[model samples]
Target chain A: MTTTLALLVDLAAIVLLIAGISMFRAPQRARLGNLVAALALTVAVVLVLRRHNVTGLPLVLTGVAAGTILGWIVAVRVTMIQIPAMIAFQHGAGGVAAFLIAFVELTRSAGALTPVTRFSGILGLAIGAATFSASMVASGKLAAKLRSAPVSLRFHNGWLWLCAAFIVGAGIALLLEPASGAPAYAAGIIIVAAAAGILFSIRVGGADMPVLISFLNATAGLAAAFCGVTLENRLLIAFGAVVAASGSVLTLVMCRAMNRDLLKVFAGFTPAAAPAGAAPEHHEPKSPGVPPEDPFLAAVDALKEAESVIIVPGYGMALAKAQFKVVELAGLLERQGKQVRFAIHPVAGRMPGHMHVLLAEADLDYEQIFDMADINGDFASTDAVLVVGACDVVNPAAMTVEGCPISGMPILLAHEAKRVIVCNLDSRPGYSGVENPLYESEKAVLLWGDASDSVSQLVTRVGGEA
Target chain B: MLDLAIMLAVLVCSFIIGYLLISRVPPLLHTPLMSMTNAVSAVTVIGALLLFAVETTGLEKALGVFALITATFNLVGGFTITDRMLRLFRSDEHHQ
Candidate 1:
């Protein structure tokens, strides 16, 4: 009877897991699926504990209660702007948990573990430790607590390859003699893996962060799955595999979006801007075209006459926390019978899908948002293009300039619109450190100020004019 | 050996299914999908509980306790955040 009950519980958990993952594919039912998955997981935990006859129930409950409260506090306090950092931190937490379990399993077994267990245990320790430390660095960069640019050692790739080779060697040593000096080998693996993680992440600049974060997330999942093998648990293995696979797919998608080679990213090779001597003028605003106008009046005038408007938002908007204002501006335009749509660049914000989260938070209709491919063609026919806190993505340098850092990177054709209005704080270059030629285009006008203030002012002025 | 083989097969099959399913999720929901996957990855709680259940040394027990806490934190925090984000994605019409 006990065995039957345990099997039934496992079966139920598996069903819920399948259902929950499937539901995520359907946006309308995602909330319900998430709830079901969470509840089912909790039930599985209780059943597993009961079946195993775990002692110290009070202590376990206390740990769980404390953790839940801490997690809940973080989830509640974090804003849309901080979601990328928050995601990195969560991955770090999961990595730490996996590392802890793998460590305990290895030490307690004391060289008596089977070959498979030893192999998986070492794999888990290495990946878990790397994921934990590397994610912390990634989180720091995203949150602006650390340098956003790539920081690397003199021989960054050399160090990465050396560390990886050492880890593999240690794993083989442990496999050959699981019972001898096992703890020493495991500790060495952890240290080297952590170093590798830092090296890997620090060399990746802001532009490639989405891909880096997704890749680390997948590594963390693989660590947990390996931990499952060491512990002989089917559920952990299944879910971990799911995370690993999905994360890999997401990584591929992010790479494609950036037009980067996946292997090059892992090798710490990002495209660098060619010698500035060849294109010195690309760094300065050569033509201030139509003298910068009163942003509010200019924006109001443009919207008043616009039959269709496209709003392009970027990391600056996220920094200023102006998504709601942009949405309000779009809403106002819609009411005026001006067709307004959002043009989202794949790498617009600090993280993947960052703009989508910000826009979604502002309660805008999803149908009004379009990706670069879907909406790039519409810009030429659109009456006005409002470039909000975005520079590089709308910069025409990617097409016209040779050997530029962002050359060949697909960007929105904001220049093709009848009238282009760019709202940014200053004429500073974008993350790629290249001046946007679109800023100097005769059809473009710069609106310099904080994104939120500029948008709010434009909203008030446009409303009054209407 | 046979048990290990079976486990490997399950891992491979589940991974393929997961990849296919997650690929179908719209790009607009990638953030929520990421958070949800993080929550589900907390399945390590099973291992932690097992460690606590088996008779073990004091050091091992402490490690097990720590693992349990971290895993629980990830699971609860991940789900709550995912739900909150998903709520923001619903059309206001649906909310009303």
Candidate 2:
């Protein structure tokens, strides 16, 4: 094929891919968009095969076959809450591919590459290696295989700087060293960069995981782009660039939603202020002026009487595996001819938009869910707010408390509703360690137990009432 | 030099277009969006394939296969899973 034709084909594939992503703005169009993007990739791959003089066809087929089988098995079986971990693991795999390709190209070239390509190869090596390691850590945490709290060392920022200095120094060394010395320096860069990746990710904890995962998504794409530059492949370069951009947008969106800057998240800025796992078991043990009433019965009575209701869910709901019951209860309420909508905080899940996907898996009507911004105003007018397995997101203290850990963090105005019912594991302060004042309010009823059981009860009670 | 310029242009232009296109995607589809883009990043498989275009040393061949397998795994897994996730949204359109 002619060079102009190849470039044109590359552009065509990229345009198709962009079209696929653009369709994601609508829920109904996204599935078709995904297929279009896959077709674009298939076309790109076929073009590469036709244009290049590829050898060892059987070997290549073996690798592709193995990968496809493994991927198919995992993809078919993995559940919704595991999506973050699974995506992180895949990013690690991409990282491995990127770094290995970069390393092989650098070592095999023997100085044949141009200066820019050579620099790109070194960059790909560093980023790919780091992304691999960091993604592993992130995947482990998301999967609950590793501790979710930020693990900070003494002088953690200083260690990060050292990691940076070493990566830069090694990059220069690879550029300057004799071609014979390339392997040793490349290995050094990989090792240090991997360490840097771990260090960079380990300081981000719990709720901050969405940002860490998104950032790793960007680095993984960046590594691929650099690998493309070294190989001088337009298709690869364009695809990688677009993925990198998408990841960057998600990362920033996650950062902004949480009211945090990217630096403080990755920098371990306030480890002492909120030791992640150190949340108090319960917020307010005393009911200052109490009615001797059962919270569950009160919740049932409240739900039965309310004409309009909103449900707020947090990560704890996912942990309790209560999504099905939660959705079931929503259906019951809807069938009762009540106005029911779900309010989802952007930071509610382990990753961005996770709660929506989790609830979607339970087959809830997509129209019933609303973003926090879109539904925060509705809380005041709603007759009842049901908070399931959540704490911080519904905490009225975020808006009212001065200089508190969660102060200024956007929360669902669940507190604004005429009545509030909390179904949680306990009266615990959430990950933020801030005492929620919602539990003490006169309108609030607390049902402390496993979320699935509590939600199922609500489903049963709501159904019986109907 | 011309080749380098073309490659750079592709990267920059694609990035800006991607940013413009993806920024409009609702948070409802963000997970699938990430999954699909991640699959796109697996395009490093091209670089992996190039390694086999020429005769390779034993070490090089091993690394080449490793890269190929992981890249393809990322690609297949990412796209298939994204398709599944996106279907959730599509199927919901029929519901009340």
Candidate 3:
């Protein structure tokens, strides 16, 4: 195949991949379509390459096909809660691809290298390889395929600095003899980098995985792009660029969610643990004033009085897989001649659009879901807020608590509703792992059950009354 | 070699972008979104490990080893955290 054509095919694949990722926040059908678009684009590119006679290993091709198929199935069958694992797997694949391509090029031209090229190659190879390893470990951790623990060795910073110094020294030595013994020196750097990455990750609490994983993903993509640069391949460069950009964006988002500086988190650091004897003792939310009403009963009342109702959901809703039940209850309420709209916080579920995916599963119309900013104003005018499994995001604590784990983080204002009906089993802190104050607010009521069952039962109860 | 450096830059940039994007999503999407990305990065294991056997330059071999090690740690650590987080969903076990 002509170089231009191959480049075009590769570019198309990259574009499709980006589009698919972007649409992940859209409805399931839309997400599925986007994913299919990416797969089709990839297949088209592969076919074009094949026609041009750019051959790939049978194993690579097979793996791609298998991955695509499996991804499609998961995309269709799995809930949004499962989407993070899938994304992690894809990042790993992209990282591996970049690492391998670089390796192939390096081995094929091992004996011949200018000082600069050798230096760049070693740097690229080390970073790419390190990123790949880190990404894989992160994937396992996020997917629940591995355990998450803070691996803290004594004087970790000192060891890390020592390793860094060693790598720099090795790197300089390689520069002196670029063509002959540089790779051996480069190997030492890679080992140190890997150790540093592991050690750094181990010190962070599990809550920070989202941000850490995203940063690692970006590293993997950058590694691949570096390989492309060494090989002077434009397509790899472009694709790698896209991956890196997307990962960076994700990392930024995670950082914002946690309200932390990206650099601080990456510097092998951890926040001071809740000081000994300082963490507020866990206490049952002393329901203030009148007890909060049952979400089901509240829904029935809302159906009876309101012309428009907006349902707000958070991570709690996703955990319960209550989207279908939410739909059922919504339908029953609509049948009572009231309008029902779902208010989805941007980061509402577990990944992105967790509520949207769940609602989509229940087969609701895409138009019915409302963005938080778009729907927040309507809460006061509405009759109820049927909160499910969510705690931290919907809890007013983010804005109310000064030094809480989730302080200053943006949250859904479920507390703003005239009647707040929470379908939670009990009080528990959220991703930031802090207690929720919303439960004690004057307007809130804890429905007390599995979100799915509660919503379904509410549907039945409301239907019977109707 | 030069190409490799550029690719590395791209990877780092994309990761930063990914992090930024996560900030905007609601809490519901945080976990699943993370898990999905975890899966994507997990693929690095296969990609990095294969390079070990590919008779690359000594530098390439070292890079491959580094990739494998990091990938192993990230994948394992990520899953463990995920499982722990998921325990929140078992509403029956926790609250009275």
Q: What tens digits encode model 1's per-residue C-alpha lDDT throughout A423-445?
A: 88777787777777787777886
**Model 2 residue pairs with clashes:** A282-A427
Model 1, C-alpha of A154: deviation from truth (Å): 0.9
Candidate 3 regions with alpha-carbon error over 4 angstroms: A1-80, A111-120, A145-175, A179-191, A202-210, A264-281, A284-288, A292-307, B1-96
i-RMS of candidate 3:
9.4
Q: Per-residue CA lDDT of candidate 3, range A1-466, in tens?
A: 3356665665565555555455445333233433343353335334434443322245334444454454444444544456555555555545555545554545456565555555656566667656656656665765667765545688878887886787678767766755566445655666776666566556654456667666766676566556656655444444455546656776776677556778656554443354367535443434535653554565466556657666777655666677778888888788888878877765444344446556655667656777666777787777777777766668687887787656777766767777777777666566565666666766665676688887787787778877
Using all chains and alpha carbons, the TM-scores for the candidates as numbered come to 0.93, 0.96, 0.71
Candidate 3 second chain TM = 0.56
DockQ of 2: 0.78
A1-466 per-residue lDDT for model 2 (tens digits): 3378777878898899998889899898888999999998888899889889988889889998988888889999988889999999999999999999999988888667877888999999999999999999999999999999889998888988998898888788777763878888888889998998898888878888889888888889999999999988888899999999999999999888767788877877452254456545324354523454766788889999999999998898899989999988888887788999999887888888888898988888788889888998888889999988788788778789887766787889998899998888887677776767788788888888899999888888778866
- Report the lDDT of model 2 for residue A69: 88
Clash pairs detected, candidate 1: A111-A179
Error of 1 at A246 (Å): 2.0
DockQ for all models, in order? 0.70, 0.78, 0.11
Weakest lDDT window of 10 consecutive positions for candidate 3 chain A: A26-35
What stretches of model 1 exceed 4 Å from their correct place?
A1-12, A269-287, A292-296, A400-403, B92-96
